[model samples]
Target: MTETHATLPPGAPAFPPGRYGRRREPRRRRPLLTTLLVVALVAVMTLVSVRLYRQYGDPNYDAQVITYTGITDSQVLVDFRVNVPEGGSAVCLLRARDRDGAEVAREEVTVTARPDQRQVTTQHRLATTARPFIGEVVRCRPPA
Candidate 1:
């Protein structure tokens, strides 16, 4: 009987005698300064995100569809509520949807500023191509 074995070059270090593969040392990791820098970057990004949301993301005002006040064959009437800063006005998008959830009409309505009140209810009328099943206030924002 004869046995055959793989061999290494004369000057090369052999693998550990009893192991199937060479042992590998654990990889080095970044130092504390690099980790802290990444953490600081993430914190800064989070702060900026919150600041931007507060500035332009509807935090200063709120809008809600109070009720579907009325409807006609070609128009929908909605009563919605808005809360705004004192003396600030809000422009709202009122939309009407049919039974299939398709938007039948959309209208932009503006609520006048009321320094004496923070919340107000307003009516909006949207013209539709078909009969509307529901009416809603889609969005409201400060006038540009």
Candidate 2:
């Protein structure tokens, strides 16, 4: 009887040998730290944009006095005007206020006028005498 065995070449693996079938090291990341970094960047950008806009935006105007003439029971003929530049539209926000500055009634009107023009006029019916008339300039813009 003759016995035979399998043979391998020199310097080659023999299936029980070196460095084969090794598990690779896992990569590491800090999830909490990464999320905090993203949040900080967004907050910084928002503050910068708000500051820049306020520096370049237009000036603000508050509402002024109310003027009324030729009053009647149901309707009153009144001239509404706002102090604005040439080629601008005046917005009149009408409201009624008690002596304590509390709002009682409210309405809004817009008027466009050229330079060196007279007051803008609109007629409105009185809703309630319990509230005194309050008028304010809301906005002014060029004619489109």
Q: Stretches of candidate 1 above 4 Å error?
A: 1-28, 36-57
lDDT of 2: 0.51
Overlapping backbone residue pairs in candidate 2 total 0
RMSD after Cα superposition, model 2: 13.7
Report model 1's TM-score to 2 decimal places. 0.68
lDDT of each: 0.82, 0.51
Which predicted model would earn the best TM-score? 1
lDDT tens digits by residue: candidate 1, 1-144? 221234655665655564565557988887998999999999999999999886668855688887885688799889888888887888888889999999999888889767788887887788899999999887788888
Q: What TM-score do all the candidates reach, one by one?
A: 0.68, 0.37
Q: Scored by Cα lDDT, where does model 1 land?
A: 0.82
Where does model 2 exceed 4 Å of error?
Answer: 1-57, 60-63, 66-81, 115-126, 133-144
lDDT (10s digit) by residue, model 2, range 1-144: 121235656664455434456534987989999999999999999999888765443333222445654443333334455545545565555655545676555656666557674444445443535544443333433334
